[model samples]
Target: MSTLGMVDLQVNGFGGIDFNKDDLTAEELDHALTAMLATGVTRCLPTIITAHTECLRARLRALDSAICNSRLGPVMIDGIHIEGPFLSAKDGYAGCHPKDAMRLPSIENFDYLTEGLRTPIAMMTLAPEHDGSTQFIRELISRGTTVSLGHTRATRDQILQAIEAGATMSTHLGNGIAHMLEKNNNPLFAQLGEDRLIAGLIADGVHVPPYMLQSWIRAKQASRVALVTDATAAAAARPGTYTLGDVTIERGTDGIVREPGSPYLAGSGVTLDQCVRNIMNWHGYDLATTFCMARNTPLSVLGKSAIPSVGDIAECVFWQQHDAQWHVTGARIGNWQVHINS
Candidate 1:
């Protein structure tokens, strides 16, 4: 039996550090990477959520430096998934992006933010409802960036139109929009009903229930689904006050959620390793399929040709199973054992 390795498709912050802050430091990036490697994630898309264009662009510039001349360990930032400022503001389904910062998608805005990133943006999540959004989708695809649908109120036809225009994915598929909708047409179902696109789901059990996870995996199959964390500063930190730039999360012993009086679950405190364990326990998916969903499948969605091949960026993890329970034993970074868990 082969042990599973993980690739996190979305993570905002880790080790009590946040990406959205103007003060985001390269040392914080190293801390986040080290923590992820300890939990068996070899590579990750360090997601930066929607914010003021200038703030996002500034963080990207700093992150580019850390990523290009990496002194960090195995949990390197392979690319980024810039997950919105261009999104709907409807309640119940929209993300935690501030109202002032949220707006329609524009190519000029995206270019400003991603100009200096070393790894380049692998994907961007936006609502298709904004003006010229379809043309924007085409442009990103043409530039070799994968576009993902998220934080939208798009109808089935609208989503299909965007898909036709080369929008290839749904970011955190079931979590970005309102929960209840008119029968047969919502962003969640619109995405679930389609097969041509890949969708990312947070399996931490807070975002989507077990039955929903089963249905998605059944509909899309393992190869077309990617597991994402969408984690924040609380990920590897002790449960307490954590900041995501200007926003704050109150992570108690009960897990992470938004601050007092808020109803939304902001992001997860779950590590990528914990996400794999939850999928295995909740759905009974095969280990190979699980690993592929967590790793190779996301790489494919980001438009990479070859994935995890020998002699090509030797990022891997070694874990042991005893009595059907797995534990991350170690991890690697391009032929070097970067960390070993006792």
Candidate 2:
């Protein structure tokens, strides 16, 4: 069967390559992206999560340089997704991001991060609970960057305010929240109820349990949802330790990535293809509906109009399914076409 190749909007690293490191080489970036393409991903955003100011800047420069220097980077890298250095520092809302590194949004911080980078910051995730978030959301959108709310305990009003200020998305909607919620007013309800926001969801059963995932897809109506890997170096690799920015995360044999001693998830080790299968497995959605979450919907949040129309076979994915598993047999990207031996 044929479909649009998957687009990953929030992948941190893949195939043993961590994009958070400032010492990555062009060859390494190419290797990681190649691994991604083999798994049916054609475009992605190399996400760099929260870090100290200097560390964040250094990592951005290194990633930008590697992308500019790498062969596959230009074709596969849609843009960069900066998850945070501006999220809620609360206990559970923080996820695996370093708490002390997060700060309130600032124009100076945004300028500092984007100073001379060749690759653009296509999307950024932040919290609406911060005092000046409304203005920062406005500034980010004004600069043509897609703004998303994440890793916060923002009330419904706060979320609405941020939406009014131009935040149009939520990152990993069901996963970045505090496990125990207020029952009536919470981040999940606030974001899910707002049709203005397209939710980026990590369908890895590890990040979100299967039953809840089913409900999330149902509530979002499956149309305005986007599937994101939010993967780390542990992704597409066997269980072991990996880097997510400066933090150390371990992927257990169960396929959950977390800090050495923490029970909370650090990042995921799921691939986009696996995620597509996962949604269908958990919710019984047809392939076409599931593919839209991984392909067209994400680009829409970024205001990108590059959706492949009918008969646009120039760039496409060829796949086959066996026993409920989807395998990427081959793909076409521009003038390039090759078989994937997976």
Candidate 3:
């Protein structure tokens, strides 16, 4: 069997690096990319959460330079995933993002936030219930940007409308919600039933329970499910307190990251490599099927080729399962060959 390189579409920060911060240097960005590479993520989109306008611009510019300068190499930073400032302002739905920064979805504001950046914005996560969001989704799709519905309180009708308007994915389904929800009428069920939307799941076993994860996979099927880590700065860092944007979060020994003194999760501490293992263990999937969910599904949704054509020498990762755990023992990216167990 041929190996497949993993791709992560929704990652905020990793290896003690926060992409939303204003002072993020190129060196720190390089370090974060290297950490991701170690975990078998050959391609990724660095996600930026909700923040002030100027702050967002600064961060975007810094990231643009980091990619253009070859700080992490040519193919590591495939694109950028802008997650907020256009999301719902509801309490639990907003998660740890600054409530004051939330805004109605608009292309003008998006243009302002991403001004003068040469890096392509691959996807944007927003609340589709907001006025003009449907049109905004169409506009983004026109410009070759994928729109994902998330951080929302949309009705079932609104979700369908977003899908009709070219929203093709969901950011971290089963998350960005309050502990309590209306039993039947909710975004979770609405998204699950929509076959057009490719759902992103964080299978760290903490974000979404095993039963719910199994249900989502069954509902959406493996082909339409993309596994993402949604990892924060705490990932690959020591287990302790760390900052995600402006919020302080603590990573416990259990490997779950949460807001200080609260049960609400800040983000994930697990890497994508760990997510693959968890999903396989939870669902009893074969290694090939698991890799397709993590790699092919996301690449297809992002309008990228899922695999190398016949006679092409594509970069890939070789994995070995031991004691019910999956490990990336080697990887080849273009001319680069990385050996993990040598």
Which pairs of residues clash in candidate 1, taking residues 3 or more apart in a chain or in different chains? 93-176, 93-177, 93-178
10 residues in a row with least lDDT, candidate 2: 305-314
Per-candidate Cα lDDT values, in order, are 0.78, 0.88, 0.87
TM-score quality measure for candidate 1: 0.93
TM-score of each: 0.93, 0.96, 0.95
Q: Summarize candidate 3's per-residue lDDT along 56-126 as a digit string, tens digits.
A: 88888887887777656456777899999889899879988899999898888899989898999999999
CA deviation > 4 Å runs, candidate 3 = 309-314
The reply for model 1, stretches above 4 Å from the true place, is 1-5, 73-75, 305-311, 335-342
**Which digits, one per residue and each the tens of the lDDT, describe model 1 over residues 1-342?**
334356787888887877666655667777778778778877788787877878878877766666665556223666777888888877865667776788788888888778755677878888997779999999989988889998888989899999999988888888877767878777778888788789888888888888888888888888898888888888878878888767888777878656545877888887877778888988887677677888878878866543554656666678778678666778766554545545
Candidate 1 overall Cα lDDT vs. reference?
Answer: 0.78
Q: After superposition, how far is residue 40 of candidate 2 from its true place, in Å?
A: 0.8
Estimate the lDDT of model 3: 0.87
Top model by lDDT, which number? Answer: 2
